[model samples]
Target chain A: MQKHFITLLFTLSLTGLNFANAYEMETTFHGVLDLRATVTDSLTGNYTQGGYGKFALNDGESFTLAQAGGEIALNWDNGLSVHAVANAYKNNGDFKLGLTEGYIKYSGLPNASGYRWQSKLGVFYPKISLENNAYAWASKNTLNSSSLNTWIGEEIRVLGNEITLTRLGRINKDPFDLSLTVSAFVNNDPAGSMLSWHGWTISNRQTLYTEKIQLPYFKARMQGYDLYEQASSSDPFLEVDDRVGGHVRAEIKFHKKGAISAGYYNNNGKPYIVDNGQYAWKTRFTHIDLTWLLPQGIVLTSQLLHGDTLMQSPLKTDVVNNDYTNGYIALSKRIKAHRITSRIERFNVKDNDKTVGDNNTERGKAFTLNYTYRLSKPWFLSTEFTWIDSYRPGRMYTNQPINLTERQLAFAARYFY
Target chain B: MFNKLPIQIKFLFISFFIIFAPSFVANATNTLTVNVVDTNQKPLENMVVYVEPIGHKVTLKNTNTLEIGQANKAFIPYISVMQLGSKVKFNNQDNITHHIYSPVGDNKFSVKIRSGQEVIKNDFNEAGEVSMGCNIHDWMSGYMLIVDTPFFAKSDKNGNTEMVIDKSGQYKVVVWHPQMTDINNRITKTINLNSAMAVTMQLSKPMDEIPSQQNEDDFDFLSDY
Candidate 1:
């Protein structure tokens, strides 16, 4: 069914492109190239190599191609547009390339009453992050994203349709604008597997649609354990229970100076269902986001998220049950051609079930400071420093410290086209 | 000597005075200066100020097409005033695409203009405030006040605009700003403008917050959000 859906989406996109050509639509291509030099001090190996480290790089100095991303858009005069973004990454002799997001959007003109409606179809990220507003879902202020947004990038992609209704404040002659959005999606039943197994992480690496995340070495996956049948790597986008999920969000914008939004998401998967070595985990969360343009050219953004996940066995017994919470506050200021940003984050996961050897309990705090200088219209130079302190009992199984502190410094050169 | 004068001579004198008296009124030139200020008495720039004759007809002048440009993801000339029936042209000066549209009254139009391209729209026939925005960039906002009369001007940085009018009688002077909290974003005062006049229009309430056109993200290479 997923294959058929993908094929149908491509077919529709082709058809739309043909129609766009006939209508003399405007097609644009934009992209960005990011290169980074990094130095890290981490005792454990990185999670990409099946270790419990938090950052993306290993414990050494290296120069790497962080990302080369491209986006193509076809916009018709009739309020319809098709957009697609793809990215490539080369890190530590490992090369990865895949599509990040593709969707068709329809934005209707505001009516006489100042109400407008828009809709999107296909695979895309949920509207939960206030930081990753740049191209290819890159964080605008810092090199690393907050824990809450990192998890969203990793596992919370929507493969369905979303509809939004907005009341434009200017046209309505009101000081406040309001919008409501609702979406229904599929192919995300295994959304919470990595969060429960590997705990929360803070990185700017977004999982591609075809990528599977590697899990850390854990005792629960060993022989004679409850999760012995679990896969070593998690396919987060797989459909295991064939159940539909839904999300609803509402926002109030103060003219255009700032906005506050709240949302609820539920992947109503039926537990105890396993398909192709992927287990269905019932996951639900509620989140709030705020973006305010403060005085003195300062931008303030923050997000708070709390959720729970459950995976059960065939006997209706809990295998992994955990409650998680993540929050962050960031402030950025721009002076002429330079910008500086700082953020503080807190995250926690509480194990609620008696799943021996599968310790999902963890707590962590992180701080990030970034400074960016605009070299030119399309070129930017940035330096960032990050510190993370975390405690996880499961790390002790691999002879690693239960309490860990890691730090990284990176300098990046970015070019946008 | 007056008593001895003929009745016809006296009647002619009175008639001449009556006939020439209205010509003096017609030839009288009125110099009007409008000062716009916020509630705190701070000068408010870019406010649209216009005078309309209440009981007389003013011929609408034919105006050249007004051009609004897009550069650095912002609309040039954030506020404008044009006569009714004038045309508007949107020019995309940046090396990017812009989808400009106004969703109000008869001025409603949506056009997609590529970089170094321009689109001319001939639908300024409506006499009302038209608010425009770029569909691609939500923060890019521009306002145009289309008035039926030709006597309209936007206030300068000092909140002053002067107009010299001949044959001005009862006139309605109005001040408009997109962010003004008044009803319809306008404040009106009816006054007789038969001589040199100065009017000060102050807001009773504070203006609504005007969103900055500068994008906080400052990234032009962004996809749809």
Candidate 2:
């Protein structure tokens, strides 16, 4: 299926390019290679080593290749364009190279009902992140994304079609514009498993498309419960409980200064049914985000998210219900080419089902401060410090759960062209 | 030696040069210094100053192609000054497609220009303020002031302009800017340029509001969705 999708994408892109040759073709290529040195300290001595079931770290300092990716966009005179991105890196030891996203977009929609309509059909991430506005889905300010956005990067992508309608206010001599977005997708049934497994984590790593992630806690729990081995590695894009799911988003803008947006996402699949070691999560979430451009190059941004996922049997006796909530507030200021940003985030996940041996209970808070100095238009040097405070009752490998506070300092040099 | 000479010799020498020398050397050029300012007296940039010859025709000899480049989603020169019959070329230097058009201008036409691609030249045969806009980019805007005379100058940041008119006669000096509120009632001065001198003009009304250069991220979406 993936191969067929790629072939179709190439054929369409080439066709667009050929048509563009009759007129004009404007193509752009942009990328960033971020090299970083990181030092992490954990209080519980449980180094954050395991992926998802992060028990402890490597618990040391090391120079690492943080992220490297790029995107290519080809535009034509006839309002046809194609965009694609690929990334290769190790997210704390899970190394893989994968196509991040690819899409064919048609933007020349006529204005009707005081609105203009556009559509995109491909594999792409939804326009949900107010922070990841930079190239290759990287955060503009800090090295790592916020906890909520990090989860979004890990497990959410629309592998289908998205339609957008926008009312251009200033173009019509109005003071404000409004927009609505609707997307239908598939091949993402495994979206909510990691959210239930790890609760929420703060990191700069994005899970690749084909990478195999290890879930130690799930493996241990299966073994401890005397159940059959349910595979050690998880694939986020497996088709399970084959179904189509979607989301809708609405946005309103006040001139060119600020905007407010709200969205609701749901994958209404049956989690009780599993296929190819993947389960349908029956997950849903409500997201609200705001961006305000303050005076003097200062910006204020905030996002609030609430959601739940459930997996259980037909009788509903043996079930696991995970309720997750997270929110973040950020302030950023730009002085010429230099930008400084700081954010505070809080997240929590509880086992509302109260099932036996439920290891999905965790609550955490994180604070991050970042500074970026742009040496030139494409070269940037930045430093970020993040501290997370949390208590996980299920992390009792030593037969005792400990309240943990982890701190990491990272310095990176990046070039985007 | 000239002082020792007769007053008639000095007068004849001066008269000889003044009459026949001007015919030989063609010293009809006179410098027209124009100082333009806002109500606050700040030197306004991108204002065009030109001399319109009255009772006679001043033929324009030098005509060139004017380029209006689109870079970073903006017209390189926010305001363009051109003479009648001047050919203008729109170049897209940025890595994107630019659909350029003038809705209400002397030359009303539209063309889709792509990166690294060239479009057909546009000729400004009529004299008027051509308000240009991009169909693709809503916030992108520009202006082209087309005039009949070649003796025009766009004011610098210091709001100072100097045009060397190769003619001495009664001429009407006119100034234009994109932000000018009254295009019909422009600030004009009728002057007799027998010699080089300085002239200052003040705008009777404040300039129209300059278009805002909002960030590109402000309207990340192309349509309402």
Please give the distance, in angstroms, between residue B191's alpha carbon in candidate 1 and its true position after superposition. Answer: 6.3
User: What do the candidate models score in CA lDDT, each in turn?
Assistant: 0.85, 0.73
Top TM-score model: 1
True C-alpha contacts between chains kept, each model in order: 0.55, 0.05
Which consecutive 10 residues in model 2 chain B have the weakest lDDT in total?
B216-225
* lDDT tens per residue, model 1, B15-97: 99898988978868889999999999998898999989898886648486888889888889898888888888888998877
lDDT of 2 by residue, A249-328 (tens): 99988755788999998877677776655566778899999988888767889999999887765444435678899999
State each candidate's clash count. 0, 14
Docking class of 2: incorrect
DockQ score, prediction 1:
0.41
Output the lDDT of residue B44, model 1.
88
* Residue A166, candidate 1: C-alpha displacement in angstroms: 1.7
